[model samples]
Target: MTDFSVLAQTAKAWPFELARALEKRVAEQVKAGERTAEAPVIFETGYGPSGLPHIGTFGEVVRTTMVRHAFEVLTAGKYATRLICVSDDMDGMRKVPDTVPNPKSLEQYLQMPLTVVPDPFGTHTSYGAHMNSRLCAFLDQFGFKYEFLSATDCYKSGRFDAMLRRAAEKYQAIMDVMLPTLGEERRATYSPFLPISPSTGRVLYVPMKHVDAAKGEVTFTDEDGRDVTLPVTGGAVKMQWKPDFGMRWAALGVDFEMFGKDHQANAPVYSKIARILGHRPPEQYVYELFLDEKGEKISKTKGNGISVEQWLAYAPDESLALYQFQKPRVAKKLHFDVIPKAVDEYLTFLEKFPKEEPAAQIENPVWHIHSGAPPAADVPVSFALLMNLVAVANPTDTSQLWGFIQRYAPGTTPATHPLLDELAGYAMRYYRDFVLPAKTYRAPTEHERGAMAELSARLKTFDDAPTSDNLQTLTFSVGTDHGFENLRDWFKALYEVLLGQSQGPRFGSFAALYGQSETAALIDEALARG
Candidate 1:
């Protein structure tokens, strides 16, 4: 077998930092015979099924998958890697989300397992299954490789029986780790097992009346005033948050798991519970919360922040993939405003990857984003530039973009330039939604008009084809000679008069991209209006 471990040790890639740390920790466990060397490295992501999947859910899985791919590269595919997406569908529904219609109906089903509650939309058998399918659909849209596991199925199939019994045996220790985090009243009645009410069919949070550790059973009184006894090991019970998290890690032998920073305080408690239950907790990754534009954490149930559909509407999947590929610890604002930049950034990285040395290419963000198989061709056009072109040219169809694209990068076709085609589609949508309504073109100042006229005259002097540099120099000279204080103000005037935006891509690149004749005609039209 190829020894990629040595290669992993020497690589300076950003992903290797996390991959090596995990590998080293696991390697120590192997050396001590705590784990077998051939054991598959499992990367797991948790999802809450109380509501539809949001952008944050997409982020967690995409980010975890990126790390999984990096780990695979580090192991040279010698060690097996599996990404498991586990949904906490068995958890009781605490509140009905606003996104669901007629939420009043949900009050009756409160405290019931999400898997058992009727899907408000009536699209599926239950709310949990619908939400889980939504999560799966989002991942499918990105063509991500993963295994979907449901908490409800795991319980019903008896896969969690052993862990349930272990929790009952270590009940007091689990309570000791969790109780201090709760209020005095909650601490007095808290039990790890939430037995399913025999009458109401709801998961009951009421205090456990009796526990038999040896029998793996818990007894509780139903709301109907009758005693209920059931084995906690079967489908009759589910553990609370901390204990459940720990139990899953131990039972599944997960190698890595990630959660939001909001769970940072709870991580140690879960780790302790895992250790007490005879397994060490998986390697933990705590990511900062996805905050709104106001800098508040975006709540999943509020249906706040950009939705997965919303981001995918204006941008491609790779753009969002790049957004999630950044450092997990750094908090990022998720909003529509972030899409264009992220899209351009992804394209920029794609454009640069082929030119870098093998060592640097391996470390490139695009490498990890594309799972070491980045696209070979570099489409020189940027999403922002394309958006501006759409604003200026007002293409009736996507084919119009080909004219401008081929001017700079010849022989580029929709067939050959798939990303640019997709980007053009995004640009049109973005221009219509964000750019068109806000457009307010200013009539150029007389001085600005004169400068533009000079630019028009200078462009006419170019006998040969105009280069971006030459066009840039001419545009710069017009501004400098016409008493503009700096090129910043000059470009500002150009964008305001021409594109009706305060900022844009390099004007020279834009001029060359739009073709000299069309650019000259644009200046003439602006000068006429002035």
Candidate 2:
């Protein structure tokens, strides 16, 4: 038998928000005093399959999986853990996503369950299946461990039939939980189960004419005035969003789930519905939504934000994971501009993690991002600095970049420093895409030229392999003597003249990474202003 007492204490000291939630959930389960210790803990994440999965989908699953891993550690083999990625594929198609083709044709399928609509891309059996495949591909890209569940399959297979009957048996109770959330007009006629039109094959939201819960059936008149009745068990009807949420909890026995902050209003209704069905609601955590550069919530339908494919083009998956590992509740802007900084920050965390104490290690972001064993901290240079070097050096290949890296960090190779090598490529791509096109180099002033000359002369005093500390001291002295108010302006001027960029990585580190002799020549090149 595993004793989680010590693990529980350790979890309390952990600083991550997700970890803290896991600790609380675990402690609650232990306190419940009725459940068996060996029962599997169900951790779930939800996806709306109305459109292609975006980067936000990636963030949700990855974050939840991180918490699942932490829970496993806390339990220490006392309980099994299962992560299920549930897709709301049974939801009606509200709008055609810009990413999909044939918009005009898809308009006819509006209000139909995505599971019954044809795949516009001709990829899979149904639109929902196509989107589910895309989500699986995206998850597989990151090697995520999860079991995929389709709402359509769950409803059709009788797995959720019992819950559906329960929802109908307590239809009035379910409506009570949702009516308070709706406007006056919508409250006049609302049913928890939306029956599918047998003739038109579309989701019909009309008021249920009669619900025979004992027979597990719902009858409704279609818009065409045709009487339709079907058993609620076999995909003939699907529960509405609020009640469906709780039904899913009771059916799957989900221990934990997370959602966006926008859903905070509907959470209580879901909890109430779960209780009406005689099951406790799953533990829930709300994370802030990702906003576009304009500070509006990113929309999957409008394609207003960057896609997962777009992010992977210019940054590593680990960098994206690092971004998700930050405080989950704080809203952050997501755009191409954030990639370089995130990549550099990831490297910094990797470099610092090995030196931290054992207790401090658990709190480090890299520890959670890597899920315990972080990669070796072999990167001696930052991604920002590498981008700067890529811009100035204009290397035709990675060897030139590796040449500079090998000089200061000797004997490191691509195999030894995979992340650094991969980041070098991303840095170059980012420089070409975002940095190089907009850069305009301003000629240094006469005084600045004199400072550069003095800086070049001082660098000649040190041999080819000067220490970074010595290089920093000399660089600072040049800034002080040049009458610059702050050292930041000094570095900006140097970057403007040398790299044609207004800002760059730490000047001392850059100077030492490039040999002392090469650095002096670069200053001379900047001073010549040719």
Clash totals in order? 0, 0
Clash pairs for candidate 2: none
The regions of model 1 sitting more than 4 angstroms off are 1-7, 12-14, 101-106
lDDT of 2: 0.83
Residue 408 alpha-carbon offset, candidate 2, angstroms: 3.0
lDDT of 2 at 447: 75
For candidate 2, the TM-score is 0.94
**Which predicted model would earn the best TM-score?**
1
What's the TM-score of every candidate structure?
0.95, 0.94
lDDT for each residue of candidate 1 in 1-530, tens digit (9 for 90 to 100): 43444556667765677787778778888989988878888899989888677777788887888778778777667678889999999999998887787999988999999999998899999999999998898788888899999999999899999988988888888888888889999988888888888888888887888888999988888889988889997689998888899999888988888888989988998899889889878888888888888888787545568888899899988888888887668999988889999998888888888888766677677888888789885667888889988987999888887888897889888998887898899899999999999988899877888888888888877786787888888889889999998779999999999988899988888988888888888889877876
TM-score of 1: 0.95
